[model samples]
Target chain A: MARALAISAIVAVFLAAPFAAPSYYVGLLTKMLIYALFAMSLDLMIGYAGLASLGHAAFFGLGGYTMALLLMRAHASAWIAFPAGLVAATLGGAVFALLALRARGSYFLMITLALAQVVWGIAFGWRTLTGGDDGLPGIKRPVFLISFADQTPFYYLVATLVGLSALAMWAVTRSPYGLALRGIRDSETRMRAMGFNVWRHQFAAMAISAFFAGLAGCLFVYNNRFVSPDALHVVTSAEGLIMVIAGGAGTLFGPALGAGVIIFLEDFISSHTQRWLLVLGVIYVATTLFAPRGIVGLWTDFSTRKRKP
Target chain B: MAISTTLRRTLRAGLAAMVCAGLPLAGAGAQTKTPIKIGFIVPTTGGFAPSGEECVTGAKMYLESIHYEVAGRKIELIVEDSQGKPDVGLTKAQKLVERDGAQMIMGIVSSAVALAINDYARDKKVPFIITCDAGANELTMPGPLANPYLVRTSQNGRTPSAAAADFMVKKGWKNIAVLASDYAGGFDTIGGFADALCRLGGKVTQEQYPPLNTTDFGPYATNLDRKADAVAMFLPGGGGLRFIKQFVELGLKDKLPVMDIYAQSVYEPFLPQLGDSAIGIYSTLHYASPIKSPMNDAFVKAYFARVKHQPSDNAPDGWVGAKAFGDAAAAVGGNVENAPKFIEALKAVKFDSPKGPIALDKYGQVIQSMYVRQTEKAGDGYVNSVVATYPNIDQFWPLTFEQYESYKYRYAELKGSLTDCAKVLEKK
Candidate 1:
């Protein structure tokens, strides 16, 4: 009952966010939500499936670039462009899975990283198509029944989509397929002995994760109204991983919470000081030392300890 | 069961924290009689951090000169680090305008970042002053990208190189070897040089474009055309440092008369490290520390006292940009809230800056003198000695607006093909 109440309260806050806060904060909140979705999708692979892919931003960038190219160059409608971006991301994820699943453990990480670099190189070097390092700018927000040109309407639109996506992800996590994936994570040999197709399950998880990540990327492009090769860079992938680990892997809510924490902290700290990168580094170090399993893990430990005492 | 409970409690805590954070920040909005806010965005934490710092220092020096007061209003300068990312720059710009209530925005060291913020500044109607090193031509050119809200006080990428081309052709170095970093700025600069040279009856014999921030210049240095009359290069930052070192180490320095296109490669900061290797190398740029002028003398003294070293091209860019803002605000009598009047005042701003006499053209691109300098030893350290001066040079120097616009190709379209520069010259 309390958990239900808490979830409702959080939703209530998001629904009311645009009304209460200034447009700048609303825009920031929108970014936070998009990143939350991105981080949670990565958690499906890292937390649930035990696959630590370092090149996840490739999917994100593919989705964004597809949407941006379609919108800016082809002048496609939002309806067509949005779905096209997701399809591109899904196809990319499927191909990456086919190649990367050949390796497991640390080697899987390395292969994923190499594959993503190939995508990044294309975005960076292809001057005519991708605008090289200059990137494709002046991408306008989509117009539907009503224009999302204003911040408030856009925030509400993003909120509704992200909310629905999160609920779907939560349902997937609670399903029997999720249990089998967790089994594979803990003991692949045991799951295999039980007649489970470990490779097939992991591949499906990869595709699904990529789909959600793609959705996040598309939303992000709309939010920023711009996309660049920076979206595909390794730094973005690393940031996604950090969000998952710092939020507590395997918990759907954990990574989402972690994304919010990181995005907010970055903005808050950078505004106050020029040495924000140094300060952010120190905070990450502290988080690693104090909350190894993440903020969620730390909370669980403290609450359980209190109960025991 | 325990996990769900923990999640609930965590969510509640996060909610409380966010609301608390948002309320205070949003409530602190702008009011009448508040200090005029000027948001300065620069890459304070990336590869361009050093240059960004110098740019900020120059602006701060200018602000200090006027005691930070304009037309009975105190000037509040807010510095935000872009980290050299376009997305980050846009976000910072949005924050500056929407959150901080800045009337004007200034200072971007990276061209990509400047382009990213260009449209945003236009849409927001915030006056953007390009200070530091963002030398993208599209930002100031008359095209789809050109914005009235944006004005570049810094040189366009092609300005210094055009001057260099004119000087090189006059010096009988008709057959030139061109080498620059493989990017938009590099192509723009080299293309300008090649266009001017071709028009002056010179031709480029060889061209090499190394990637930005290239640590190894061994291949490029070894492969440089030894037959050309001179080698013109535009390798900036660390790449320039490395290339010069390797050029000397491989004994290519003596074989070729190298010209530092834009002179940023051999500016004051790199002179001590370059030592004798940079000596006798001719460079073309808008600003050199060794220029003999009353304004330059005072600027050099003030900069050295504050920074403990001679200023580079970036410092002057910052100083000049800030002065334009100050001059415009003073013209409007501190009524910067009147955007149209302020912008008109800004366009008419002309002064003898630390670099030289600077005035904005109708398109808001800077028109100033370009100096052809040589690296000569002064005492123990080195200085860029002005060897030739090209006065009253605009973006389209030596060519009228009609002539420049009549060209079939933009400078960036001539990448890796200096021979095609003849096509541009043909139009003239």
Candidate 2:
């Protein structure tokens, strides 16, 4: 009951965030929520299911452009478009998993990168469909009963969806299928011997992860009222990977909190100093050197150490 | 198209779900008929922010002069940062039109962004008053799908490039090497200059196309045919920031008088970045506030006061473009749908800009006076000192379709490509 109450309070604060904040703050929070949603999806794969996805933005962009092209050409509604986007992302994720399940470690990472690049090329080279390097413009986004006419309302809508998606992910991860996937991650060879089709479990993990990432992309488009080829670029993929690493990769809520704080810090720092990138690079290097387990892990260590003392 | 039952069910379900989710109905009523919103996308918050920042200031000054209110209606200039990316610019332009309720649009620094915006505006039916970005006249032209609302104030890549090249040609410089960025604007201006110089029987001894932000111009300078009579190049904004400074550092300024196609690329504001060495370079431009115009005098005084720095060739152009948009707004009397009438009024329009007189062509390109300016030291230290004026530079570049097609100039039917492009300028 206490946790449930805490969850509701979190949702309320997130929804009200942009309204009370300035435009830049609103934009930052909106991105944070979308990224948080994306991070949660990654946590399901990496944490619960034992699959790692570095090329997640491919799914994100797939979902983004699905909605983008639908509205750009066919005038599709966001209500209908978001799910279609999710399905598209899921299919993309499945294809990726099929290619990647045969490999492990560095090879898996390489295959994922190559696949994401292929998707990015499609977004870039196919100008007639995706506006090439230009990107799909004049896309009308659907919200829950009111079309998002501005950034603030869009923030609220995205915040709501992100929360719901997180809850959905939380529920799924706590279920038996999620447990089996986690078991597979812990010992894929053992799980295969235990009469479980480990490949299928990993595949399913990827599909579900892709769905939420795509949903995040869809909400991102809604928040920004724009989509670009930058959506599919490697830097974006790296950003998600960075968020996961910084927040403690295998922790469920950790990725979300990390995504939020990190993005907020980026927004604040970049705005304050143009050399924020240099500063961030220095800090990232320091963090890796001293606290390889990341912020949450380090905090946990501190609490345990203090209690022992 | 044949649809399966699942597809039909899904589409229908999606539609129903959207209704539940609250998709707003199209053609929604406006809050006010007379509230004018001008959506703008520029290279703000990036490497080009220096230029974008000045353009924004220049636009605001022009808008503020009229109090962002024209014909008793309030004006709202909603600006977005494109960050010098093409996709970002296009998406931002669309949002400004559809969501922010912007009636007209303006400003973009990169040629790639301008090209994207030019196509999008045609479908959206919002008047887009493009100011900067030197992508030639391939954006708008006369046709059924011609962007009726599209108007531009900035000069194209050809005018200045050709003028400088033609001057070099007149000076009997036979063998010239060329250097340009490989992108759309770069290619167009370089190609345009080459065409002009080559037509005058000059040989382009060597050509180099570098990436936009190549801080190292050592290879470019060393590799150049220093023996050539001249070296013509096209570069703008921050790209020009590094190219010329490094070229001079390599002692090319002493050996060869740089006949530059891109004048705005080398401005007075960024002179500090280039240092005292970046002087005496000759380039062609539409306006340099000291070019003997009442508007120029007023603009320079206002701009210098605002920036606390000497204004460059672009400051006047940005201010002039915003004023042109203001003129059209004043003529429209707050009905943006009547923009066709406003455009007709605009065709008949003559505004006192920093460049003297800005005349609209048959296409939207602004026909303006071009000045061959040499950088010099003054009380302000360094500026684009006007050498001579090539008055009323127009779109008709004395080139037949056959002549343009002789070289692989993108597409052959040059007239068909830039069918309706042009309008009038300031980058602001």
Candidate 3:
């Protein structure tokens, strides 16, 4: 009952944020939601499947660039461009999975990084199509059933989409397939011995993660109406990793919360001081030292201890 | 449990820290009269930090000169660091306008950042003045990308390069080996040189575009056309510095006379570091510290007093941008809130800048003199000593606007292809 109430309160806060906050803050919130979805998608691999991928931004970038190019260059409707973006990301993810799943642990990490770098190189080097480092700008928001030209309407669209995605992800995490993924995470050899195709499960998880990340990327491009090689950079992939790790890698809500905290802190701290990167570095160090399992881990530990007492 | 308590305490401490930091800013904002806010964005971090710092110092120095007041109203300047990323720049632009309520926005060091925020400033109808760097030609050109709300108070990418091409052709360096960093600004600047050179009956012997921030200049240095008259380069910042050092090391400096298109490699700040290697290197730009003028002397004096060093190329650009803003605001009777009137006033602004007499053309691009500078040792250090001056130069110089715009190709489209430039120039 208490859990239900807490969830409802969180939903209420997100729904009411646009009305309460300024347009700038609302824009930031929209970014936060998109990042949360991105982080959550990453969490599926890192938490449930025990696959540490460093080149996740490749999928994100592919999705964003696809949507941006289609909308800006071809002037395609959002309905066609949006789904095409997901298909592109999914294909990229499937291809990466084929290459990356051949190895395990650190080798897997290296391959993913290399593959993402290739994507980044393309985005950076192909000046004619991608606009090189200057990037492709001037993408207008789609006007479908209702014109989401305004901030409020756009915010509502992002919120509704993000909310639905989060629910679907939650349901995925609780399913038997999630249990099998956890079993593999615990011991992949044991899962293989039990006649389960471990590689197939991992590949599916990766593809699914890429799909959600693509959705987030499409939302992000719309949010800014701009796309650059920065979206495909290793820094972006690293940021997603940090969000997942800092929020609690194993849970859906943890990464979402982590994304919100990091995004807000960065914007807030950067506004206040020029030494914001230093402060952020110190926070990361503290997080690593004190709460090894993340914020969610700390909360769970505290709540259980309180109940016991 | 111990960790959880520690986490709780950390959360509390962070909140306290935020409150402490917020107090002074909150107090500063509680003024009786609402000041005319001008938002300035520059890369205070990342690779472009030095350029960004110079721009900020120059802008602040100008504001200091006016006592932060124009036409009886106080001008409150809000500065944000873009970190040299396009997306970050857009976010900061949004924050400055939507949150901070800045009447006008100015200052950007990267062309990418400028282009990123150009649409935003246009859509919102906010006056954006490009203070330092950010020399994309499309920002001011008569095309689909032309923005009414935007005006560059600095040089276009083509200006200095075009002047360099003219200067080079005059010096009989007809066959040039062109080398530039592979990026938007690089292509635009070097392409301008190629186009102008071709128009003047010169030829590009060979062309090489090394990627931006390339550390290893070994391959590029060795691959240069030995038979060419001179090597024309547009490498900027550290990459430019590294390339020159490597060129000198490889003994190629003696063999090939190097001419910098934008003076990025041989600028005031980089000269001291390059030392004797920088001597006799010719370059072209809008500003040099050693230019003799009363206004320049005053600017150098005040700038030295503030920053304790000679101002670089970007400082004057920032100063001119600020001066333009101040003049426009004053002309509008300090009512910068009157957008249309203020924009009109901005276009009509003309003043003797530290560089030279500056004015805006009909397209809101700066019309000023381009200086041909040669790095020479001055006293104990080095300086970009003025060699020659090309006065009253506009973005489209030599050719009339109609003639220039009649070409099917822009500088970007003509990248690494001097033949294409020649093809376009040959038409009509």
Best prediction by TM-score = 3
Candidate 3 to truth, TM: 0.96
- Give the residue spans of candidate 1 off by over 4 A: B1-32, B422-428
Candidate ranking under TM-score, highest first, comes to 3, 1, 2
Report backbone clashes per prediction.
0, 25, 0
Best by DockQ: 3
Model 3: number of clashes? Answer: 0
DockQ of each: 0.41, 0.05, 0.61
The interface root-mean-square deviation of each model, in the order shown, is 4.0, 14.9, 2.5
Instruction: Write down the lDDT that model 2 would get.
Output: 0.70
Q: Please identify which of the two predictions, 1 or 3, would achieve the higher DockQ against the true structure.
A: 3
lDDT of 1 by residue, A1-309 (tens): 999999899989998887788677888888889999999999999999999999999999999999999998899999899999999999999999999998999999999999999999899877768887778888888888899987889988889988998898888878999999999999999999999999999999999999989999899888777788889999899999999988999997899989998887787779888888998898678778777888888888887988998
lDDT of 3 by residue, A1-309 (tens): 999999899899889988766678788888889999999999999999999999999999999999988887788999999899999999989999999999999999999999999999998888788888878888888787989978889999999999999999889889999999999999998999999899999999999999999999888888778888889999999999999989999888899989988987887788878888999998888888877778898788778978998
Screening candidate 1 with a backbone cut-off below 3 angstroms (N, C-alpha, C), the clashing residue pairs are none
The TM-score that candidate 2 achieves is: 0.67
In order of DockQ, best first, we have 3, 1, 2
lDDT of 2 at A104: 78
